[model samples]
Target: MMYKMQFPKIVLIIIITSTLAVNEIRFYPVEAIPDIKKVPEEYPTIQAAINAASPGDTIIVTHGTYNENLLVNKSISIIGENPATTIIDGGQRGNAINVVSSGVVISGFTIQNGTGGLPYSGISVSGCNFVVINNTVLRENYYGLQLTNSNNSQIFNNVIMNNMYAGIYIHDRCSNNAFFENTIKNNIVGVWSSNSPSNVFYHNNFINNTNQLQAFPPMILDNGSEGNYWSDCIGSDIDLDGVGDAPFAGDRYPLMGMFVNFTLRYGSQIYFLSIICNSTISNFHFDRSNGKISFDVLGSKDTVGFCRMASPLTIIKNYTVYINDKVPIYIGNWTVSNYIYGYFLYLHESEPQRVTVMLDLPKNENPQSLFPILVATLLIVTALTIIILIKRKGKLDKNLS
Candidate 1:
């Protein structure tokens, strides 16, 4: 009928519509209960409990022997009450715990006696991410823990021992894994990795196993091993700083020939005398002058007076030369019957008369007693004869005038 409504009635109608809209949308209280889905303890098996649980559920295993293989098909937390008491026996068939899905936590349990005829393991993790295996004991399996095509896994503080193949086998594109503070011992290979890279293995004691460690040889050729400890090193810490004095060249097959030859001949005493003589002889120098060769020994004591030459003097051999009072020079090569010590100077010339050689002795030494005294005595006699003749001629001229 196109009739106008009052202002108060319009405001009242708006308020009623807003209230209806608010009431139409459901409102629950702040302290409301979540959709709790409980897993019963009477499920009689861990697998039955897992089937009934959803994605974000925890399957708790009580203290008993669950002699069944577990396959985690979804993201779930499988916790055991006490690892030392909870046993997941594989009945000598497939893997005891196979995680096919990601984000799974399998902690605090003893996984043992698992067997697959062709190289299966106690726990086989495939294509999984963010998986944690902690405080777990894996023993007596073909492989303790086999990680294949997995990434970003944490394996810490676990004891993996007495396995058939390898204690920890990371294979086929597994990377970014942390293997820390674990006791891995008594296996065929403690840790085996084929073509895996960028992995951290630190602060782990690898002790007294049959084969403590091994890696793919070809992969090591491309990616080198850095900062690893070997239990078989026998070398000195020369600098007293805990590192080796020489670089530890690892078990490279190509260098075995050189190492064998070096070890066999390195400590032999055949060259001992030669090494000593070479060290002594390198300290002296030789020079020749005026039909006389002089040896200017830099640090020889003044007790050196005469020099002696000894033999088979093939330039420098056991060519012992001595210095006492006079310098002895040899013109030609000679073999001596006796051994002489100290410096011996030698000069060689075809015409010995063309050069004169003189030996200057120390001032304290008496030239009269030295063997070269003959030449000095002859010069004094010639001077006395010339002086007597000159005085006699002067007296004869005075008498004749």
Candidate 2:
């Protein structure tokens, strides 16, 4: 005797509805939102639009000069028309732009003439989790990119030249920041850090600066087989691996010449990797899910080739690199950490070869509704159990007969 239990139809509907509701709670990234506010057309000034705009809004500033200091205290993007034509003059007053809140992006603006005293910079990032990319910080009175107590930030693809103190400065308490593909040249100090650790820097061109790198306490510069290219690195590549034979002070894999290429794609937008001082790259691909890349090209002899890609993963401690579909080898290359935006991977190549890359969606993107799946799985299992029970009961009745 097998008996079937009756279930309420309303209960099943409620369960399905609740599962759908839970899945409907979606948190979109900044790139997913499509609301864009134009400058001068929608609002008179960048700050004015910021004041009127809400979070997750984008402000596009057209080609022009804005003679004013900017203060960004909200989570938004301020994109300029072009880094060369679009300019933000500080009027020789204070920092050109001061970011006080996280989730802020300041891109494609030439920030100049931030004059005051020591510690003032063309772009001062005091908030955590911000992006300062594709901008020119030139002739600032103090630092070009200043990170004071800010953590989880990214400074990329910016020409930080002719600053008084340093091109890039990371003071105390600022950890887990990343600097890549920047041309830090002609400054008194190319890159300086004081009592700050866990900061990842690579693929940058430290060229023509008075002092290349000045860390109060000596710090490691390479993430494994990849590092920045310094114009003053006296080491040579004897084995033709494109990596320096001897350590360049703190950098282990210092390049003989400047050359690097990297790109990042999230959602539908594709961002070309920022180029540092002077170098060229051939081809590249990255597997964001596995933190690996398929490196296909290194420059021929006398040239150093590098290709890299970044993903939404924040902690990229190591990479398993593959060359021409060979066996994958694990490399503990500390590319970048908590890199405000995502994880970045780099590889050094020597010869030109056809490169192929496979990138996958992030692990957490459009997560499936677990509740529904789980309930469906349970229903199947329960039905199987009921069938087995019914068959067994029928056999028992036949035996009894």
Candidate 3:
């Protein structure tokens, strides 16, 4: 449905923030929070909508090839209909989208073809704070995304590859920013953060870059126990924790394989989890009633197939990992802050297998749960039998009378 909306921002008490409780996080999904103003339908171009929008308004662009250099000076969200189909070509002139305002969000678009220099980028955020660039594809540009004097932003789940100079260039006091679950590959430099520090990177897959990183010290490359996956890293996971023992590409606790971010939604709510695995995952199912989460993972026989999951404690806890109803090797579990991070080794010998993580119900188990069902069935059968006997008795009495 297309909506040409200009609704004012609604102020709800108990506002959601990055520091909200994990349970409270799922209550407010990202899609439900913003007032949408459709592009092309409402306005001809994305830049036009930005020009007409209020500070907190959201501009949703439908799937089409839009060739323009957008300059976003106001705080708003520019979301595409679909990332694979939505194209924002810069035409090799300027940055595809230049964000100079704080609290800006650009998601779900294929932004490409910026001029080949540090000044031009697919998406450039300058002097902005609390910005988010996610679920977008940035390729064939000078720099996929560049941050200049930006602070406290979250960049995740982006495919940034095949750029000329660098996939991402961060400099000039970009602090407290996080880059996670992004696949940065096939560039001259994957990440060129020369003077930037105090930012943390985890769960990202940096693959096949000519120069993987040019980061300075005091920059965190891991989340203490688990870090990113480097394609050139030759370290081994001796303890089978899905993490490398030695440092690789400036990451201390490098991951074993690519980090996959799955948006496993339950009903109206969506749950996000990061999984590092060598196998292909599919059919993610979640049952909050039973506290059970299941998915399938398939891998080659030669590769060590494993799924390392990290999520909030409210999502999955006290759970036993199973593969095809059989138990996989319990690698380990680590509690990091409000999240529960776990690793399991499930090798299927070139076959596909289901991986199930069933949380132990606080009060109910299998036999006890079955007892209630059996009792309910018995009571219903008994009631039917009494009804039949009463009918028979009434019919006989009526006949005799």
Candidate 3 weakest ten by summed lDDT: 1-10
Ranking by lDDT: 3, 2, 1
Top-scoring candidate (TM-score): 3
Give the best candidate by lDDT.
3
Q: Quantify all predictions' global Cα lDDT against the true fold.
A: 0.55, 0.67, 0.82
Clashes of each: 9, 2, 0
Query: Using Cα atoms with residue i matched to residue i, what is each candidate's TM-score against the true structure?
Result: 0.48, 0.60, 0.74
If both were scored by TM-score, which would come out higher, candidate 1 or candidate 2?
Answer: 2
Better of 2 and 3 by TM-score: 3
Q: Candidate 2 on 160-270: residue-level lDDT in tens?
A: 888888888888778778787677889999888988878888777788899998886655576676788888877765544445788786887886666455666543445
